[model samples]
Target chain A: MLNVLWPIFIIISIIYAILSGNIENVNKSIFDSVDNAVKFSINLLGMTCLWSGLMEIAVNTNIIRFLNKVLKPIMKKLFPDLEPENKASKDITMNIIANILGLGNAATPLGLKAIEELQKENNHKETLSDNMIMLILLNTASLQIIPTTVLSLRNSLQSDNPTEIIFPVWVATICAALAGITITKILIKKGM
Target chain B: MKIINYVSIVSMPILIFIILMNGVKERKNVFDIFLKGAVEGIEIVFKILPTLVGLFFAIGFLRNSGILDFIINIISPIINIFHVPKEIIPLALIRPISGSASLAIATDIMQQNGVDSFVGKLASVIMGSTETTIYTIAVYSSCVKIKNIRFVLFAALIADIVGMISAIIICNIIFV
Candidate 1:
């Protein structure tokens, strides 16, 4: 949990910095990181708002319903407890679609929307539901078809073949997603 | 490559166009609906802002304190047992922590090793295959105010380990 990991990260880094005599860099990084975080959030804000707006249109026009139908089999299998008519199903489908298209920024807003919907059905409200944990796992082990950022970075670095690693990326990502889902399923089944 | 680039570029615009057209055909007040959702987006961002600031600060301290290199030195011998490249150990470690930090490390790797080198290809595959696990989980869980994430973190990290190891093996078979 973040409650435990956050402090450990800071404590370990501070002690390491002191021993290495790199305390100044750590001090500078604190401020620099805050600044960077704000800038990053602002950048995220625009894209998120844009996607959220577009999502509204998609929902109002039944585009989400169409997408949900297309993704029904997969969603049903992954979230068997939920009804096909659930709002969370639509949000999850849109998030997965955006992710598959490599729309990283767009996917975050939709993913948050899906989590919000899932929270509505959560009885405990504090602890994550099984489906919520599965959603997070899916995001962490992201199944992106094209890694736009990596390809662009490689192109900028003047690689002879900018997209040469796409196939390998697919292989690794599929393996990751499968592994995460399998472990989560087992843990949930064992009442973890 | 060109076709992939083109699809990636046009996909968003095309999606947007389709959504907007659908809204019009449905006779909805498109602008009003958009504003409503955008407002919700603002609230979501505000809720997660503090989490982002804290997570970034911790990641920054970790990355700048020279600890990752120390950790890498300690783990390289163990990692060598699997025949994985030592140069990418830092990347596999950092990939799940911070996106920007991993990007920096990946760029550094490709620059030093040449973009077409075996190490470079492995780094690229790793970058594409993994996500910033802590950040994504923190933002989502915090936004919905979930206190206990349970086994999600454990399972996700397992996924990252599998992904990174697979990247190394796949790169060896395909690139080398």
Candidate 2:
């Protein structure tokens, strides 16, 4: 089903791009943006490190433990297969925390760690477990509160009110996260 | 380059110490694993490079071609029904393209209008919350080895609708 639709979608996008005169600009941008891309990457590395360090500090100070205590009942409801003491559960929680803070780059390592832990528990050769699917859905639709990265970009661009988006961003992300989770569960129930 | 090299050099020993404390018995083989990881990272980057370029080109061409304006015009009536500014249509349209590009557009809106203005706040929310469609599709599909994720795409689009609607509702309540 996807195989047929994927090509069609790509073709349509390509036609749109060509019709819209973006192909030429895109060609120019590839070269023109390289320097900017490099600079952005370097700056992002620094930001990621700072955020990761902060997260590490939080963990060491038992902030994570506190979060776990607060989130335990919710986590249990979301992930019944995961024991409270499971390393994967902890990694998943950390990833969610970083994402909520809009620290996506900081969440990558934690997400990878979570995946590694999940793979270890997957003894079966075929099909993802319900918990694994749920984790992926959650990660993909992780609700953000602060949207730090977006605000930073706005500031860099000299916007007067960089933090103004916080309220709307929080609402949108939370709703999207709920919708993604709900749809995933419904699909699973229908045996998709 | 020099600063990056210096940082890497300083960090190497710390990484090694952390790995050693983790009880990795084959401590000497850690270098090999590190190199392997680097290679794998590079491979993944190259694998996605073409798609990334394609996505960027598509977005760029669309913006330049006035397709965005056409889209805005068509969607304006619907958006007006919700009391959202017509300018926000473009940002919403581009949200699924590239995060940075959408941010650029959103920033432009904030600059033109007051950032605290209803439209600016709404655009910011939409930009911050939504995922770039192509990037999400590329990442998740590649991970699960699912060649066809059409259903997932539909599901994601539906999720994006919810996000957009929520952005409006929340902005009206808090920012307006």
Candidate 3:
């Protein structure tokens, strides 16, 4: 369904772009902004390394263990299949930590590692287990707390209060996560 | 400037050592892993370059062609009916196309409306919270080999709506 729909959506978007005379503007924007994009990517890569290093420090200093201790009950509820000592649990913790700090570029590798760990624990190879589905859903709706990248962009744009939206961001993301998890649970119950 | 440069240079080796110690491997594998990571990074850049170019062009054309305004106008009545601020419409519309572009728009709104303003904060929150719609759908569907994701697509769209509404309400309640 998506294979057909994706091509159609892309085609429609292209047509829309052409009809709206956006193609020319888009071409200009692309060329004009490529330099900035490259610069931004470099800066982002540096930031990612900084944060990942901080995460590594946290792990080495046993802060992650403390976090895991606090988060254990919640993790149990969210991922019932995985035991507390499992590598999947640790990877999930790391992924969620990276995500909450708005280090999505860093989180991708952790997420992949988590999934691989989960796959190893799975006994059946036929279909995705319940835990895998839940993990994907949760990951898709991971709640960001700091929104570091957005704040950086705001700061770069010279906004007066770059961090002013932090509370709202937290609230909105928490709500989305709750709603997504609820819907996912219902869907799973209904065998969808 | 001299002090800063000296500090950075002095700290560089320590930083590398710390990162190396985080893994179980010795100094040799650190270099190897860093090289591997660099290669992968370049590969990702090459893969996404075309899509980024195309997306930028499309967004640029839409803005210049006045089509964005037209669409915004058409939706203005509904927007007003919902008491949604005019500034948020573009962010909502563009969120599907590109997250970074939507952030740029959101920053502009924040600049114009005052970052503490309800609409500005809401736009920021929305920008921060949601994923790039088309990108997420494309990546996930391709991964699962699911050809027919009409239901999934609709669910994601509905999720975006919910995300938007929740963002506005939460921001208004908390900030305003």
Model 3 per-residue lDDT tens digits across residues A97-142? 6676556766654565566577676565434555665565555664
Segments of candidate 1 deviating more than 4 angstroms: none
Q: How much is B12 displaced in model 1, in angstroms? A: 1.5
Task: Name the top lDDT candidate.
Answer: 1
Give the per-residue lDDT of model 1 (tens digit) for A1-192: 888999999999999999999999999999999998898889889988888887877878888878888889998878889877888888888888889878787788889889999999999999999989888888888788889899999999999999989999999999999999999989999999
* By TM-score: ranked, best first: 1, 3, 2
Q: List where candidate 3 sits over 4 angstroms from the true fold.
A: A14-23, A26-69, A83-87, A116-133, A154-161, B1-69, B140-159, B174-176
Please report, as a residue range, the 10-residue window in candidate 2 chain A with the lowest summed lDDT: A53-62
Choose 2 or 3, whichever is better by TM-score.
3
Residue A62 lDDT in candidate 1? 80
Name the 10 consecutive residues with the lowest summed lDDT in model 2 chain B.
Answer: B19-28
Sum up the clashes in candidate 3. Answer: 5
**List of clashing residue pairs for candidate 1:** none
- Clash pairs, model 2 backbone: A21-B61, A22-B60, A22-B61
Give candidate 3's error at residue A154 in angstroms. 4.1
